[model samples]
Structure formats: C-alpha cells, structure tokens
Target: MICDQLNDGYDLVEPQAPAMLESLRAFGYNIQTAIADLIDNSISAGAKNVWLLFYWDGSESYVSIMDDGKGMTEEELVNAMRLGSRNPLDEREPNDLGRFGLGLKTASFSQCRRLTVCTKTVNQNSVTRRWDLDYVSQTREWRLLRSAALNSEDRLSCLDKVQSGTVVLWEGMDRLVGETKTDDSKTHKRFLEIIEDVENHLAMVFHRFLGRKNNLQIWINDRLVKPWDPFLTNEKATQWLPEENLYFREDKVVIQPYVLPHHSKVDQLTYEQAAGANGWNAQQGFYVYRNQRMLVAGDWLGLGLQRDEHCKLARIQVDLPNSMDSDWSIDVKKSRARPPAFLREDFKRIAKLTRGRATDIYRYRGKVIARKSSASYLFTWLKKVKHGKVFYVINPDHPLVKEALNIPIEYREVIKALLRLIEETVPVQQIWLDSAESLDKQSQPFEGEPSREMIEVMSQVYKALIKSGLSIIEARKRLTTMEPFQYFEELVNRLGE
Candidate 1:
C-alpha cells in the first residue's frame, strides 16, 4: 500500500451540476403561493405600476408581467436569473424585495418552463435574457443568453414605449395549461379566469400597499386590480384591538390584536370584507409580515384551533423588523413564518385574546347584542306563577290566553259559573274539590286535583276547542288530549314543591 501510494495520484471527479431543475422545483415548492411571492418581488422592487398580460393562442398561451421598477444591468440580470446566486447570510438593504436571488428564475420556472426577461435602464441600452427548458435539456446546462448589440434603430425600437422598466414574459406555460381544452376559445376564457384569480390574490397580498396613494398599481388585461382590505370599514364601526402590544429584543416588532365585531353587527358586505381582510374563511390566526411584506397570512402554529368561521373573524397583525427575519424561520417564498420560542409566548397571548374575542362574537352574537338582561318572558312567567293569584287572573290579560279563549256567550257563561264558585271559597283547594264532585255528579269526567292556574288555562283551552265545533264534553276531552294531563299535574306539584 505504501508503494502504490508513492506512485499513484488521486483522480478527482467533478461534482454533477447538483440537480439544478430538481432543486428549483423543490425550492419553488408552493405553486399557488409562489405566484404571490413573485408579485411581492415586483412590488418590493419599487414597481409603481405592474401589468399581468395574458395571451391565448391554443397551446401557445403565455403570460407577461411588466413593471416600472429599476431595471437590472446586464451582469445583474445574469445573476438575478441564476439559481441560488444571492447570499442568504448577506444583510439586505431596507426595502429590497429580494433576499435569495432565486425568486425570479425559480418562481418563473415553477410556473412555466421558459422565461424571458427584458429590461431597459435610464441611460444604458436595453438588454434581454431568455431561459428555455428545451435549450437547457439539449446542452445539459443553464445558459443566460445576451441579445445581439442593439443598433441605433433597434435600440430606439426596443426602448420605444418601455421607458426605463422591466418586462418578464413567461411562455411554454405547460403547468398552467394542463389538460384543459387547448382550443383558442376555451383557452382565452381560461386565461381570463387565471388573470382574475391573479388579480384577486395580488390585491389581497398587497392590500396594505395598494391602499396608499403612491401604492403599487396592478392591472390585468387592461383592468386595474383593486386592493381589497380585509379590515372591513363601513357605517357600522371598525373592529379594533383591545390594546396594542409592542415587543422588543434585538429587533422591534409590533403585535396588534383586534377584536372583530359581533357577527350580527356586520352586514353581509362588511362581514365578507372582514373575513377576506383577516384571511377569515378557513384560515385564521397570526398574519406575520417582514418589512411590510406578508410572510404568513393566516396560521395558528399548531394551536388547538383549526381555521374555521370563528377564527376567521379575528385579525392579528405582527410586524417584524429585518433583523429577526432568520429567527422567524421565514421561507424563500415569504409565505411561511414562525416565531421564535421566546416570542411565541407573547404571540400566543395575543392569539388567545384574538381567538377568544372572535369566538365570543361568533357564539354570543357580539358585544353589541350580548344578553344585557335575562329573557323577559321567563321572568314574567315566574312573577305571575309565584303569586297566589288565580291562573286566569294572570291568564285572561295575557296574549296566549286571550288568543285561546274565543268562545260563544253560552260557553263563556258556563266558565263564569265555575270561576264564581272558586271566588266564593276562601280555601281554593276546597272549592276545587267541590267543583270536581259537582262535575262527577253531572256525569262529567275530572282528571285530577286542579290548581287555579290549571283550571283557568284549561277553561280557555276547552272553550277554544268547543268554538272550533266540539260540544262541552267533547271540547273538554279534546283539551285534555292537547297536552298530557300528567304534564299539568306535574306543573301543579312543582308549584307546591
């Protein structure tokens, strides 16, 4: 072995180009959310105005997102398109939209296999870059192609309407096209729907910035995207936090917890707006943002509460400074964020309050109409029943009794005779026993000992049955049949007890 080592030199094999496409696919994981991340980049790049243009031509449909941000130079454009080119450890400038330089290439490639970027700076001539999957597969390499030098007329033509801006065109949209009917007509309709979806998502994701005067203006197919603020503002009132809590460590972060209005207090429009603003539908929890860029919209972080209607009503806004970005476990897409263990206690406290308030509003119908006092009907019934007054003393004046006692004069007279017998006796039990004995003598059936209340209510029920066309005995039987006689007997026992 020593002799062989003396003669042999180590042969080094080059490392394979580290599965570039596979790594990108993994890094660009969330297709639905990744689109939002790209739009965030466009916004963060200081793009005042952006447009999502859709072109449909059977299997050749494409999407172009053009923005008026500061366009990159030739070298910068090359680096921007390169995968994992930006150093994650390097501190970013305040307001920079990109962290890992992977956003442009990865996000674009995640949606479409081919991506072309065109940009023009103020003084320098315009540059174009294209990344085609077919070209990559053929060469087994990731190539950044520079356009032929722009001649005087070509530069004028290229710079014509683009005035210091960047245009990102995505073609070969295989993933988006999918298996849907690729017919021109169907594709156009589908493209419109996708544009609408993009518009809606961007509006919500950038709602804060969109609300500002100089905010980002996003347009899809000539139609401007309106930023939808989830925090509903209407004539009713704004839902505000019970208190604003600020936390500090090495970085400054603010946690504002809001208690939404009771469900009944908001109209459908306002409620829907609130729900949308707070990511209320099925996802509810903390909305964490870094440098005004949303990292996670609605998540409970394994808290017991799952996203549901109750949580949707809650809105907690967490603002984190750039220093704590790594501590929060923020992903490249800026779609996921996690608070540090130390910060979680504070977040959980705020989350608990927000969730509790939302649950209260959902269950108790909000603070506005919460039970200020007990139900009136139960109180009234208790008051009347406690007194020794004849049940009819309270009944005849009551709405339910009045409605039940529509009877003929003859039947009314008979009921009056029974009441007169009760009025004559000081002990009502003796009078009731005597009335039962008299009813038995007259061949009428008496079910049990009748309390004054039972007699009065029964009289009304009997008369109502008779007026509806039964005879005296038939009406009495029908009234008893209306509800269990034992139920009335139980009521009498309860009153005595």
Candidate 2:
C-alpha cells in the first residue's frame, strides 16, 4: 500500500548519539534494580553463583558484579554494548530474562558514567570493553573503549581466577557518590546503607532462585543472601489455599494464595520477620513474577481492594511466562507489571477469596485458640429472623442475662424493653463501613479490660449456679459453656477457687 513518490521522498535521519544515550539513563532505575539487570544477564548465561562487591571511597567508590557464567567473546561483547542490539519483537530463548537487550547499557548508565565489562570464554583469552559517557559526549559518536580506566585492573583481576565468567564494573558513580571526599564518614555510611538496600531487594526479587536447592547463589560483600518467602509456607499454621491455573490465549498463569497465621500461632521473632520489608499492612497483595523473577511485589494492581489491616496476612503468588511480556506491560526496569484487560476479572475474583480468608484469620484468632478445648461454643447475641426481617436477640440463657432477669419483677420489663431498643437501633451500616475503613479500630469482646474484671464476672456466675444446688464440678462446667467466658478458658478454670 506504500505510495511510490512518498516512499522515495522519505529521508534518513538518525538520532543524535549523545542526546539519545543521555535520555536512556532516565529509565527510573535505582541502585538495586540497576544491579539486578546485570544479574539477569548472568543468570541467562547460566551462572550458578553471583557475587556483588561494593567498595566505598566516597566519590571514588566503585561497584562490581562478577558471575561464573558463560562469557561472551570480543565481538559478542561489542554487540552487547551496542544500544538496541536485540529487538523487543525478537523471540528470545526460554531462559532469557532480557526483552529489549538494553538493560546492560541503560541500567549501567543510569547509575554511572563509566561501565566496563570483562569477560572470558572457556580456555579463551579475556576481553574487556568500556563505555565512557564523558568520552562519548566529547566525540559525539558511538565508541567503545579497548581498556578499563586506570587503577581498575586489580578489581578486574578477580574475574581472571575463574575459567569463564563476566564482571560488570561501574565507576564514575555520579548519581550515587558525586563529589564527596573519601574521608567523609557521613557519605560513606550512606553508601554502605545503599548496599543494605540492594541486598534486601535482591533477596526479594530473586527469592525463587536463592531458595532453590543447588540452583543459584547470590552473595553481597561475602555475606550469603537468604530468600525472603512471602508466603511463609514452612510454618505449620500457614493456610495454603488451593492453586489455580488461569488461561488466556496460549499462555497460562498460575496463582496460589496463602493466608498466614495470626501472631499468637507463631513465636514473636517469626511474627516480626513475617511482616516482610514493608511490614504486614503494606506487603499484602499479589506478587507478580516473570520467569521466576519477581516484577511486582505487594501490589493490589488497581483491583479495587484497599490494603486493609484485617487482610494484611493475605499474599497471592502469580507466575507469568516471559513470552507474555508485552501483554502484561512489563517495563524495562522490571519494577512494574500490569495485567492485561482480559485477565483483570479473574485476578479480582481470586483476590476477594484470599482477602476473605485472611480477614477471618485476623478476626477469629481467639476462636482458633478456643478450638483446642472441649468446651461448647457460646454466643451472647443470637441472630433471629421474623417476617423476613433480620435482627439480633440477646440470649436469655446466658449467665449475665439470667442474672439480670432475676432482678425484682418491677425492673424485669424495663430491662427487656431496653434490650429490644438496643437491637432495633443497631448501627449496622455505620459499623460495616467503619470496619471496612479501619479494622484495627474495631474492639474485640471485652478487649483491653483488666483480667480481674473477667475473673469477677466468672466468679459471680459460678456462685449463682452453686446456690441453685449444683456441685463445684458442674458449676465450672456451666461456666465453660457460658457466652464470652468460653473465650477465656483460663479464667473459667480459676472460678470457685
């Protein structure tokens, strides 16, 4: 359908080298994600071990990531350094984590002005290539340096010990350590803190790889990094919901929801650790992964669900294949993902189920504790329906209700009327909205009261039953069956003592 005249008139206008390269640096990658991009290449090259070393010298600081992966040759290294070397539309290998083939260059330039890559293949000579932004700016052309900057030979020596591997060196860290002196302890401390941040990010993003047995290893500054499993699947009390497979076209997305146990079910230290890096409240939602590499963590994905406290323990794992990258809208930085329109409804349905289970766990933690005992269940308020209208009725058989009924006949009618009025004026809709807004603000039955208050009430019911000619054993048994008191088995045990 091309017109001959228009096709012949079109002129060739290439992007200015300096301007495009500078613009490529603004891909919104922080220190952690930039390093992760390099690691992705190592993994694709079949590296089992990856080591990250950060040497702090303030503005002179340098960071290098070395991996024992299949290294590229001299010519391959040059092409890898080229921008847009691989097309996003090209079909990649099954294990390839890259899409646009721009991660190594863009990720490096985002953090530093100097990027040097040293690599060697099996029984082959080592080759090194450098991309200096300053030099490129001066020349205004596509240029690759033959050697790394002076004094970096020692740092690059570590790669020589291995048979075949690649080492990515980042220097002239303008964004990270600009113009700070080596003696500045404050800046030095801040640089060290960034290392900690990077460590945490890797632990989360590559948790699947780190947790695999003999799969992959990542170390930061000689310390082994452990994977942080969001599901807490190892705990005995963690609820593993049924796994589901959702399909769209030819691709399949696997989803598994987990409802973590309440704090009472686990030790204090485990509970604190389970809160994750962002704490429990912020860490609740779907975790989207592509090729076992996490892209979106602790996100609701605009699924019309708020991060409510009651559902904080809910975490769902979603697995996506790399082939669906464009469909999911995965960004180059690998920090964001959006489900395609066709799959949003399915995601919402699964989210609702998981949140329901988590809310049940949060609200009924006491009920779970009570299940261990053989005591009969009791509730002070009974739900009743009459003439198709639903409402609550106070249980007349409850110990407190019986005691109030035993008052002088003159007051019994007034007491009954007051209970009826309370039922009629129940703020159902208001309470529902308030609970949705802030579940933490809702109080549990007899919450925060002194233990003595519960004990006193238990004692009153125990004595009343005993006066009616019941033995001590029968009185204690009756107390165990009483409403509210059933939730406090220990206080019920202390009765009549």
Candidate 3:
C-alpha cells in the first residue's frame, strides 16, 4: 500500500474544470442545507451576528448571508472560494465547522449558477470573489470571476455597515426561482416559503450557539430567530433520563434521553411547539450533534427500531466530538451519521429503556408507572422478547381473554389465531407516519367523543371481575388499576353506582 513503490511510474492527470465544477453542484444540497453550510463558515469565522436577506425580484431574486465575523484577507478569500480549500485529512481547529472544505462552492452552486463573496478585515478595505457557472461553461476553464454578477454593489453594501465581516450572495438562482417573471405571485410565495424553511433550519441547527447570551445572533431579513430546543429541557414536566457516556477509540459520546410531558400535562400550544420541525413521531429518535452543531436530527441511526406513537415523547441527544467524525461516517452534507458496529448494541439498549419509559407515560395517561403491578391488576397484552426480537402476546390471565378461551374448543383456536394475527400484523410503520402527520388525530384508548361505548366496556369488565369471586370494593379497585380504565378514574369510581 506504500506510495513510494509506484511514484516514479505515475502519470499526471487532472479533472476537467468545467465538468468538475458542474458535477460539484450535484452534491445533493437543498436550499435549507445549502444555506446552513454557508452559515457554518460564518460561525467558524467567529461571527457574533449572522443575517440572511432574501430579495425577491422573481427570476431576478437573490439571497445573501452576511456575518460580522473576522473577515479574511483578499488572498484568503480567493482560497476559501476554491473547490478544495483545505485537506480533509488535515487537523482542523476545534471550532471549525467544516470538513472536505468544499461547502462554500458546492453548497452555493447547488442552489444557484452564480456565487459571490465579499469580505473585509478591520485594517483593510473590502475584497470580492465570485464563481459564475456560465463563465466556467463558456470558457471551459478553472476561472474565478473578479466581479460579481447582478446587484453586486447592493449585496456587498450589507458588509459596509460592519467594520470587518463576510457576505455571501447567491444570484442566477435557476434552481430556485427559475425563469418565472417578477409578477408571478405563485413563484414569489414559494420563494418566501423557502426563506422560512431556511430560518427554521438555522434555528434548529445553530440552536446551541443562539442560546448562548452574547455568543451568536441570527436574523432572517433583520428579524431575530429564536432557537428551537429539541428536548424541551426548560419545561418542568420534562423527564431527563440519566446521562451515559460511551467510548470509541478514547473519544466520548454523551447520550441523554428526554421524555416530554403528555398533552394533558402540558398546555396544547406548548405540546404542539415541542413537536419540532418533523412533528412528534418523526422527531422521536436520536439527535446527533457534533461540536454543538446538529448533524442528524430525529433518526434511529439504522438501529432496528420503528418510530411508534407510544414512544413519540422519547428523544435522545447524542454528542460526538469532531475527532470521531470519520468513525461515525459523517457525510459532506453533515446531515447523516452511522454508528459504528461496536456502538450499536449500546445505542439499542439505551433506546429500549427510553422507549419503555415513554410508553409508560403514554399508556398510563401521564401517570408514572409502578415498577411492580398489583396481582389483581390485569394486562391484556404483554411484550415478549425472544431471540433478541420483540413480540406482543395476549395475556391469558386477563378476564376477557380467559372468558374467550372458555368457548368451544374449535372456537378457541380461531380466537387465538385472531389475536396472533393482530399482534403480528401491527401497522408499526403506518402508525409512525400517521403519528408524524397528525399526532393529535391518533386517539388514545377510548378517547373518542362518545363515552357510552367506553362506559359499557368498563361495566362489562367490572362484572367479569365480580364473577371471579372478587368483592364489590375489590372489583372496583382492580378496575381503577386496569389499562384504559386507569385514565378514567371518575368513571371507574361511579361504575355500578
């Protein structure tokens, strides 16, 4: 594998500039992520305030990100605009939010055909550099434009207000606004929507930075953006599980699980706000952060776990040092990460525990579950783990299950088969998607508007308990402890009154 043996025989070949630059635009950056990549550079440059201005001129619309960071020199600005400004293998500063070093060019080109950067130092005048895809295509060379495309002066004016900072302008936005005319209202609305998405993304990704008092401030068209805290840690009802630190090659990964309060516990607005960008179900999994910057949000990291309504409140925070980026397979877009094989077992264990706690809160209607249940309290369904896989089994000891089993021998098989089918064919993935789409629409057990049906069922269960040789008081108490009945404590108290 040594390079010394083949160095003399190697041939010098370089990639074609025009083709290479065009291909760089295919790195799969959406408007939100592309904007985030540019913000990372602003943060790395030690910016106190970052402003994103969206100018809508229909087909002529442009977007610019200006930051009061330590602006680079003219030579450094040109290098920063290069495709590969820094080696990925080289050790980066602890605070540097970049790797592969192509975020500026690649992210810009992914959204627009033209990219321009104007920077200034405290002691020097401003300087500008640009990359125009049209110029590159026409000349078929690695050409860096000395002047920006349209509205360059107005775009650079943002930096003039600050002593030293950098401003990134995106013009020729073919991928975004396209060829729509200035009077196109539909396209203008879509453009504003994109700006809103960028604002939300920046609020979440740079939340840790924005939360700090006097650290960093982000503005969208001059309006301040508030940080979106995923864990709702400030809420009094939020359950902060024990934090665990796992090791991978001498580096530490901090894992902290949080269980949000049930809807009944929190007000409707607070509960809705805590759902995050993708809603409660999609935002239930692990949130991976690197150097306080979020990389992967609400993902299971390929672990064998499905997002379920019963566990939607469980969100885990995973903090990884930048040094372990390669081990975690951090992508250039910084939107995905895969846990190492050795760490998957640990993640699975933590996930199981958190999911169990969340289910308890969900099923018990915001009440804390007891570690040990009373013998008289019956469970209709039980979870069984076999061969490291989970399966739900109907409890034969339950009054209804036992009564159903007392039917004719031939009917018993049919009942058992039906229960098995229901357990095995649980619509896990569908439930996850439905919960994400409208969590409030997914009703809790017997939570519908008609209370008569639930009352009748509860009365029937009470009668069954009474037939099993339980005293009236004992039956009533047991009914209060049962699954869905536990939530309807007042109804259980008035049963048979």
Candidate 4:
C-alpha cells in the first residue's frame, strides 16, 4: 500500500514518440554494421542461410535481408519489433546473440525510415509488421503498421518461398542513397561499393561461422561470402601458440595466440590476401569472439600496446561466452571491447610474449639461430638508446666493421671519420616510414643480389680472420655462423685454404 501510494505521487512523464524514435538514429550504425546486427538475430534464431538484396530504384531503392531461420509468429514478432523488448540482464541461450534487444530498432533506424518484418512459422499463417517513422512522427504516437507499405509487398515476397523463415525489408533509405536516380551511373557505382564493404565486413565478423560446413552461409546479391581467416591457419609457416584459459566468476576466457607467417614465407597471392581489409599492421592484436561470433577484430583492447610494424604478425584470439559481455564492456555496436580490470594484466602479459615472437620473425629471427646452435644472427645496425631517446648506430662488433677498424694507424683516423659521418646521416625517418607502409615489400639484405657480391665481402672478412692466426677451416667455420653467409653455406665452405 505504501509503495502504491508512492508510485501514485509520480507524474506520467512518458517520452515523446517522435523524439524517442528519432534519437535511435544516432546509435552509430553504418550500413555494414546495421546489416550485421540483423544477421545476429538470424543466427540466434537458428538460421542456416541468410540472403541480402540491395535493390536500386532511384528514391525507391530498398534493401532486404531474408533468412531461413525458425520464424516468429504474430505475438512474438510484435514483441521483438518493440524497442528494448528483452531486458539485457536476462540470461540468453548459449548460441543466441540477443543482448540489448535494441539491435533491430537502433540498427534499422540508423539507415532507413521504414522497417518491415514478414515472417512465417509452422502451423501458423504468414504475419507482417512494419514500423514507419514518418507515420509515428506525424501522429506523435507509437503506431507500428499492420504490414509493409503498398507497392513494397514484392520485397517481402522472399518470405513466401520458405516454410518457416523471416524477411526484413528496409525501405526509405534516405541515409544511404538520398535522391539517387536509377540511371545515375555514379550512384550505381557507389551503391555497388557499399555492397562490397558490407560483404567484406560480414566475411570477417562471421568468418568463424562461415568456415564451418554446416554452420551458416551468407550471400550478398547471390554471391557467396568467403571467410577471411586472420591467422592464416593453412600456411605452413604460421605459428600456433598454446592456448590459455582464464576463469572469471565461473566464465572461461580462452586465449589463443598466433604469429602469422612472414610475407616471404607464403606465395604472393596468399601474402597479399592475408594483409586483410586494413593491411597487416592494423590487423594485429586480439580478435575477441563471443559465442563463436567475432565482436572486435584486430584491436589491443586499450591494453596500452602500439601496433608497430614488427608486431604486425602477432594476432591473438580471445573466445568468451556471451555471459561475459558486460564484463568486457561490449558496446551496443559490438565493435569495441575493454577487458575487465582483473583480466587486463593477464592480457598485457600475453600480448608482450606474442609481440616478442613476432618481432623476432620481423627482424632476423635470431631465436631460430640460437635454437640451432651457439651461433647468433648478427644485425648490421644496432638500435641504441641515449638519455631515453632512440638513435641508430652501426654495429662496431660486426665482422666488416672490425675489419675496417683493424686497418693501419695512418688511415684509421680517416676511416673513423668517414664511418661517423655515414652513421650520423643514416636516414632513420625515411626508412621507418618506408618500412611502416611497405614492410612486407621491403627486401632483405642481398635478397636478390648475386652470390659473388656477398662472396667478395665474405672473402675480406675470411682473410682478416686468417691473418689473426686462425686456420682456413676455423675462418670458414666462423663465416658459416655469420649472417648473409649462413644463408650461403656452400659458398662459405668453398673458400680456399
């Protein structure tokens, strides 16, 4: 009775239908993510196949997404169409992607004005419901129409072909093709490009689902989408690190770290394709998946890590159940994820290890030499730090540098001055930018040069070692352990005594 009296004292300050519905348009959904949100509904509904149609008809252009999922009836369709139909706190089925429940309304309103859903279920007749924004704004009432607008019925006809399925139609696409004419070739081209963007986005986000044979198939204008695996699992040189599991409140977070193969290890075609939509550098880091559906692709999750060129090969996979959505701070758009405070340190540790291995592969892969024997892969330039600032200096201990420094005292000063000038003028900025932009295309030392060029230099170093009281066998053995010569063992061994 006291609670009832307290409730009765409150004023009825319901939100205005016009303002409330219009506000949903700012949920930050582009065409790619909007369509993806609807597909999440299809997948949760147990859809096997989903088809997207991008029709161009000037101002009458419309897009429709039809799925062969177990369809909802009149009552269920009405509730699903309502904004915030289900509480976000409610526990959903293991495979269901129905969090927030505003994905349908917010995602659709972000792109179009008319949202119609026509669905059919077993033992139930086909039912249709439409939400026209114009009508709601005009009447200042929440009025969901009984069906799609006239002449737009043909778009919903796809639902008729399936025994139990649903078709979502998006008309009045002012946000996408505003006043675009059917004969305008430019608009047609832009429309086609948007379709391609949507295809690419879907290919990545739903790659795990699309990879399985019996899982799901998504089609855009009848063209099947192929999954773009980030890790290049099929490549022989790709490294698959051991997976670790972290438990949080009985929720298991599985982390699988991967070091993608260097561009030189794979074929040209494979190398280019594996660069992905944002190139190799931007595609590094953790790929967070919720219930086998990828959420954030290639992000550090605010772990204070930079996507440097050397770490481009490092890609980690994080698998989380939908139950941990709140823990990860998954946004409505599902593009961002922040690890909980308790798990941030664990994530940072794993990132450091993965990036370390990637840096080795990006440089000379020194660890590989260490594993083989006591030999070390020597670098020509040593990166130095002075007063917390970075600078590059020529490696003094390098065989070639040692040979030059071992010259007669009369010319030694001139050689030292020349080396200092060259070292000081090393084009660090240009080289860094060049490597950053085209690291994969950057050539290795003497990559395609003739063997004789390398042999001439190796002979100088070989002669110096012999002059220092080392035998020819010992000299050649030392040369075999040196880089650029380690790659040419036969040539190193052939040096005459």
Which candidate achieves the best lDDT against the true structure? 4
Stretches > 4 Å off in candidate 3: 1-8, 366-479, 482-497
CA displacement after TM-score superposition, residue 33 of candidate 3 (Å): 0.4
Which wins on TM-score, candidate 1 or candidate 2? 2
Error of 3 at 169 (Å): 0.6
* Candidate 4 residue-wise lDDT at 491: 77
Candidate number that wins on lDDT, 1 or 4: 4
TM-score for each candidate, following the candidate numbering: 0.66, 0.76, 0.75, 0.77
Candidate 4 wrong stretches, greater than 4 Å? 1-7, 365-497
lDDT for 136 in candidate 1 is 69
Choose the strongest candidate by TM-score.
4
lDDT of 3 by residue, 1-497 (tens): 35754676566678888889889989999999999998889999999999999999988889999999999999999999888899988887877889888899889999998899999999899999998888989998888988776556777887889989999999999999999999999999999898889888988998999999999999999899999998887776777766779987788999988888887778898888888888999999899998999998888888999989899999999999888878899888889889998899888877877887799776665343451344444577875655534456788787767766778989999999998898889775565445544534667788755388888888888888888888887777787667778777787777768
Every candidate's lDDT: 0.62, 0.85, 0.84, 0.86
What is the alpha-carbon lDDT for the whole of candidate 1?
Answer: 0.62
The candidates, ranked best first by lDDT, are 4, 2, 3, 1
Q: What ranking emerges by TM-score with the best candidate at the front?
A: 4, 2, 3, 1
- State how far residue 437 of model 3 sits from its true place (Å): 34
The C-alpha RMSD of each candidate to the native structure, in angstroms, is: 17.1, 11.9, 13.2, 13.5
**Given candidate 2, what's the lDDT at residue 213?**
94
Residue 55 in candidate 1 has what lDDT? 68
